[model samples]
Target: MATKKRKKISQAFTKSQLVKEISERCDLNKNQVTHVLDEMKDIIASHLKKNGPEKFTLPGILKIQVRNVDAKPSREGINPFTKEPTVYPAKAASRKVRVTPLKQLKEMA
Candidate 1:
């Protein structure tokens, strides 16, 4: 089967443009599309909560996860240019959001 080639986008679509296009394609009103998008945002946020599931998957599109990063201790190091001793500041442990594209999303690119 032949597949249609997609036009390369020079810039990202704005929220309003995205909503407009989705509404037209889905046969829904702009407000309805906006509501649906907002709900999706809320659902993803809830899923990545501290006590809730740290991972969320939109099948065939992407997976989002919250990962814990280990803290780094301060250390002494030599300055490359000056050849002098210096102390590197310690970094506090933090959580980060990681997004991985799925197979279908990768294929679309």
Candidate 2:
């Protein structure tokens, strides 16, 4: 028996493509769609900056969170190439964004 190959799915969208699709669906101009998307980006950035490390939910779509990662302490290690002992310095704490899909959106998928 012969098996059929499955079609690959596209998992990414560019700003122009998103703007075009949303404009068509909403019956709005591309400029308006772009503005809305830009504004949404600005709002999310502002919230993340102001709130620091916390989850910010976007209703039924998804939740975004800022995470603060602690640095690793300095440690001694052997260099593989030179076979010499070296001390690795500690890393500074940093923040990052995390995203989680809402149940409603996950269910639709």
Winning candidate number (lDDT): 1
Q: Which stretches of candidate 1 lie over 4 Å from their true place?
A: 1-10
For all candidates in order, the CA lDDT equals 0.92, 0.82
Cα error, residue 80 of model 1, in Å, equals 2.5
Candidate 2: stretches off by over 4 Å:
1-11, 50-54, 77-86
Which clashing pairs does model 2 show? Answer: none
Worst 10 residues of 1 by lDDT: 1-10
User: Per-residue lDDT of 1-109 in model 2, one digit per residue for the tens?
Assistant: 3334534548776878778767776778999998998999888887788454366689999999988898889999999999999998999889878899999999988
List RMSD in Å for every model shown.
3.5, 8.0
Overall local distance difference test of candidate 2 = 0.82
Q: Residue 60 of model 2: what lDDT?
A: 96
Candidate 1 collision pairs: none
TM-score of each: 0.86, 0.72
